[model samples]
Target: MTALFVDDRYRGAHGIGRYAREVLGRLDVPWRDLGLDGTPYAPLDAFRRVPGPGAADVVYSPGYGALLRAPRQVLTVHDLIQLQTAWPGRAKFLAYYNGPVRRVVRRAGVVLTVSETSAEAIRAWLRDDSVRVVNAGNGCSAAFTPDGPREAASDPYVLFVGNTRAHKNLDVVLRAAAVAPGIRVRTVVPAAEAAEVRRLAAARGVAERVEVTTGVDDARLAELYRGAVATVMPSLLEGFGLPALESVASGTPVIHWSGCRAVAEIVAGRGWAVSDAHDAHEWAAAMTEAARSSRTVAAPSDAYDWDRTARVVSETLSDVLG
Candidate 1:
C-alpha cells in the first residue's frame, strides 16, 4: 500500500517540524508527500483547501491536524493547549477542538502524541476507550550533547527556548529576571517576535540583562545549551518538553515550572522544578539557586532516540495500512 505524508509541517523550526523531518527522513517504508501546505484546522475550508491524497492507501500528518475528508488518515495531536488555556480566543479554540478535532480523532486510524502526560490528557478528553492513543515520544538530536562547542558569554546566563506566547509562559521568566540579579536570561524567539520580546523585556526592566536572540540554528543552539548556567522551561503547558530534554542531554541543568508536567517528567532528577507557576519570587529563587548550583551535569542521552520514534511510527503505518 502506498502512503502519503503531509510535508508542509517540515517548513518550521518547532517541535512538529522537527518530528516531521526526523520521522520522515528515518522511515524505511515507501512514501510520498501530498504537497499540502495550507491550514488544516479551518472548519469551512478544510475539505476544499486540502488536496486529495491520490492513489495513497494511507495518509498521515505529523502535527495535530486531521485530513477530515480522507478515508484512512493518522494524526499526531501534540497537545490541547488552546483548550486548556484561558486566552482571548478561548471560545473559538474550544469550539474548534471539540467540534472538528473531536470528529477526526474518533475516525483517525491512530492518534500519536509526544509524552505520556499528553496522551493521558487526550484520552481523558476523548472519554471513549475505543480510540488508539499512542505515546510515540520525542528524541534528542545528536547535536545537543555534553561535549560540544559552547557559546561564549561574558556572564552566567540561563536559556529560555520559546516565543512570547501566553502558554509558553515567557512572562514568568521576564518576571523572574527582574529579581534574579546574578543571572542573565537569553531568550531565543522567532524573528517575527524579536521586537515584541525586546519591548517586553524593557517593560520588565530586564532589557540590559535579558538578551533576545533570533535565527539560532541547531549547532549554535547546542552551543548555547552547553554553556548555559541552566535552561529554563517555563511553559504553562507542553505536549513534550523538547527544549528541557535537549538541555539535560547537553549536560546543562533545567529550571522548569512544576506545572509543566511534560518537562518535569524528563528533567526531574537532572534539574530543579519550581512549584509555583505564578509566583515570580519562586522562579527568581530557583534561577538564583540554579545559577550557583552544580548538582547537575551533561550526558550523551540514551533514553530517547529519533530512530526509535521513526520505527514506531513506521510500524503503526504498516499495521494500519495492511
Candidate 2:
C-alpha cells in the first residue's frame, strides 16, 4: 500500500463524500486510510494532516481537500465554484485558494476532476495553459437505479438535493415557489444544514411550500428522486452536478440552470430541461412542466461509472508513483 487515500470526506453526504466513498471502495491501487480531522480549507489542518517522511510513496484525495506539504500526491480538485461565486467568506477563500490550495494543485503529481467544465475552471485558476486537468467525469451510483421504492408525498413536488451554498441558487426555487403556487419544493440537505435551509425557507415566506429534510440515505434519496416529478439543480456553478445525474438515473427528469454546463455535460440529452436560473418565472414554468412529466425506469446508459473512475485514479496514481 504505497498510496494513502484520504477518507475523512467519506462520511459526507454531498458529492465529495459520495465520490470518496464510491471510489475508495473500488480503487485497485494498494492503498490505506489517511483521515484528516478537519476541512482542507483550514490552513492548520494541512500541517497536522501532512504525512511524515516516507509515510507513503504518494497520496490521493477524492475532492478539493489536500495536504500542503505532501511530497508526491494525486488529488481531485473538483471545481473552483467558491472562487468563481460571491460568498460570505470570499476574501478568506481567496487567501486559502491562492495560498495553500494553489500550491497543492500546482505541486500535485496528478490532478483529477469530475467534468470538463471544472477542468477548464481549474486550468483558468492555475493560469497555466499547459497545466493538464484530467476529467474523470462523474458516475451515478447503483443505489440511484430507476427501479426503487418511491417516496409518497401529500403534494406533488420537485426535488432539490444540495446544501444551502450561495451558488446553489436556492433563491430560484424559493422564487419559483412563489411564482408557481402549484409546485412544492422538497430539499434534502445535510443534518447540520437543515436549520439554515429551514430558516431560508421561512425568511423567503415559502416555509409551507418548501419541505426541508436531513440525513436521507442513498436508498431513501433514490426513492425521493423516483417520486419527484423532477429534480431542480439551480446551482450557478458546480464541479459536477451529482443530483441531476442521480435524479435522471432514478427515472425522473431534471430542471437545471442553462448556465451550468457541468450538469448539462453529464445528463447529455437525457431527462433534462434548460432554463435561466435567475428567472423565477422560467423556473416556475419548468417546474410546472416537470410536474406533468412522466417517464419509465431505465438503466443508466452513460459511460461514467464508479468502477471506471476508480480505475482511472488507479492508473493515474500508478503512473505518478512509478
Candidate 3:
C-alpha cells in the first residue's frame, strides 16, 4: 500500500519533522512526501488537493493540518494548548484553529495524540472521546550518556533546555535560581529570542548568575545535558516531556513543574516534581535537591525509541489500510 504523508512544510520545524521522518522510515509500505510547496496545488491548497484513501490508498499526517476527503485518514495531534490556554491574543490563535482545523480533527478516521492530557483536551474541545492516545517515545542519543570521567565545572550551575515560549515558564526557573543566590543557571534558548531573554535576565539582577547560549548543535547539546548539575523544566504544559527523558538518558536528575500529566507519567517514582511555587522557598529546595541528585541513571530509554514509535504507527496504518 502507498501512503501519502501530508504536512504543510516538511522541514519547517524540528520536532514534527523529526517525528515524521522517523515514522516514514519505519513504515513497511511505500509512502509519498506530500507537501504544500511545488506540488500541483495552490498555496494552502493542500486541503483541496489531498488525495483520498482511494487515490493514495491511505493518508498519514504527523501534524493536525490535513483535512482528508478520503475514506481513511490518520492525523497526530501533538497538543491542545490553544484550547486550554487563555493567554493574551488567545482569540486570534483560536480563530484560525476553531472551524476548519476542528473539522479535520473530527472527521479523521483515526485521531492520534501524544499524551492523555492532550487526548482529554481534544475530547473536551472537539467533544469527541474516540481519539486514541499513543505515547511517543523520547530517547537520548548514544551521545547524551556519561562522557568518560570529566571533572565537574568548578563553579556550581543549573541548566534548562527549551525554546523561549510562554508555556515553558523559564521565568519561574530563573526566579527560583535567583533566590538560591550561589547557584548559577544556564539556559539554552532559541537564537532569535536569546537577546530578549538576556535583557530580561539583566533587568532581574540575576544577570551575573545567568548564562544564555542559543543555537547549539546536537553534540554541544549532549555535552550540556551530560555536564549540568541538574536540568530544570518549569513548563506549564508539554505533549511529552522530551527534555526530562533526555536528562535521565544523560544520567542527570531533573526538576519539573507539575502542570502537565505527561511529565507525571514519565517521572513517576523516578524523578522529583515541584508544584507551582507559592514562593521561592519551594523552588529553592527543589533546585537544591536536583543539583545534589545529579548522578541519576535513566537507562532503558529504548522503550520509547523511534523504532518502537514507528512500529506502532505502521501497525495502525496497516490495520486502517486492510
Best by lDDT: 1
Candidate 3 C-alpha lDDT tens digits along 104-219: 65655457766666766666776656644554444344556655443256666778887777777787777777788867888887678788788878876788888888766556
The C-alpha lDDT values of all candidates are 0.80, 0.77, 0.65
Per-prediction TM-score to the true structure, in the order listed: 0.93, 0.91, 0.83
Range of the 10 consecutive residues with the lowest summed lDDT in candidate 3: 38-47
For model 2, residues 174-230, the per-residue Cα lDDT tens digits are 888888888889999988988898888888788888888888888989999989988
Please provide, for model 1 over 1-322, each residue's C-alpha lDDT reduced to its tens digit, 9 standing for 90 to 100.
4555553544467777778888888877777777765555555633543455654566777876655666667778888887877767788887777876677778764688878998999999888788888888888889988887997888889999987888898888888889888889998878899899989999999999988888878889999998898898888888888899889888999988887788888886787788888788998898888877844575635768999888888887777777
TM-score, candidate 3, is 0.83
Q: List pairs with backbone clashes in candidate 3.
A: none
- Superposition TM-score, candidate 1 onto the true structure: 0.93
Clashing pairs for predicted structure model 2, backbone only: none
Off by over 4 Å in 3: 8-14, 38-57, 67-73, 129-140, 147-152, 292-294
Residue 156's lDDT in candidate 1: 84
